[model samples]
Target: MTEVCFVGDADCDLQYELLSRETAREALSTYDLRRPFENAIALSTVSLGAAVSLCNDLNWYVVRFVDDVLVREPSVDDDEWLSRELATAVRDGDVTGPDTGEYLKVYGLEEPEPTPEDPNPKGPPALVEPLYVSRQDGAVPEYDLRDVDDTVVVRLTEGEFTV
Candidate 1:
């Protein structure tokens, strides 16, 4: 299965923003939604092609409410995620799964605050600012921007590399 995760923009409540609209809601109706991160929503698709197609179908809402779009294809790397652009490239056969891990955007994941409504947190950790890095000798550097218990690494295309 290919998992697609949408990180919400800080200013908006992502779930409400997407589900409130009829078009976006209908487009996402078929899949089961999961909140993997504090401001994120995730869904599974059968293949990389399906994941990219769904993202393209919801581009309007994504542009307005999402901060990032990440896809995880088990055929690629089970632990690491791919940027939306890279995922699309892979789905289209422009890039190979093995060649997708050179450039990465690493986001620090902080522990979530326990809320009164939901005390026992089952959601994934919250994401912080991402640090762009390139792998060297098949090893990626640790995220040093802040103190985080975990990190989410999103593989990027060379064109998407920022630093």
Candidate 2:
């Protein structure tokens, strides 16, 4: 199966910006998946066709995030639900919300640097920032699957497909 993950440096480089549910809904609309990604890649054998389709759909947002990521810099909208539930939290002097670390771990990913000494870093703080990921559920890909895939890797039998 196609492992849905932020596997590469390129994907990690994409700032982990958590979109508000409404904002994400809008983003989804751009792709005609106005609804949640109700699709599934087979658990153990993702077909080439499914991978191609998912890869293509994900590529569009990758481009979009690269272009507009900075505009929503985390210093302002760092937390996940704040944009929806706590828009005035910062201005009202309330503690905002979670950071990059708390968010990325949910996806079994982590960004070691939450803040850098550069004083003016180049990209989003690692792990703490929730990067935009295309998903099979509601806003931001939620691994809220009912049946988690088996942790054990399954290898094909040596002669399973041989004549």
lDDT of candidate 2 at residue 34, scale 0 to 100: 15
lDDT of 1: 0.94
| lDDT on C-alpha atoms for all candidate structures | 0.94, 0.27
Model 1, TM vs. native: 0.93
Candidate 2, which segments miss by more than 4 Å at Cα? 7-45, 66-163
Where in model 1 is the C-alpha error above 4 Å? 114-123
- The per-residue C-alpha lDDT of model 2 at residue 141 equals 46
lDDT of 2 by residue, 50-103 (tens): 333443445544345432111111343322222211223332445333321122
| Model 1 per-residue lDDT tens digits across residues 38-151 | 989999999999999999999999999999999999999999999999999998999999999999999999987679997986767899989999998999898999889899
RMSD after Cα superposition, model 2: 19.2
**Candidate 1 residue 48 C-alpha distance from true site, Å:** 0.5
Which model scores highest in lDDT? 1
RMSD of each: 2.1, 19.2
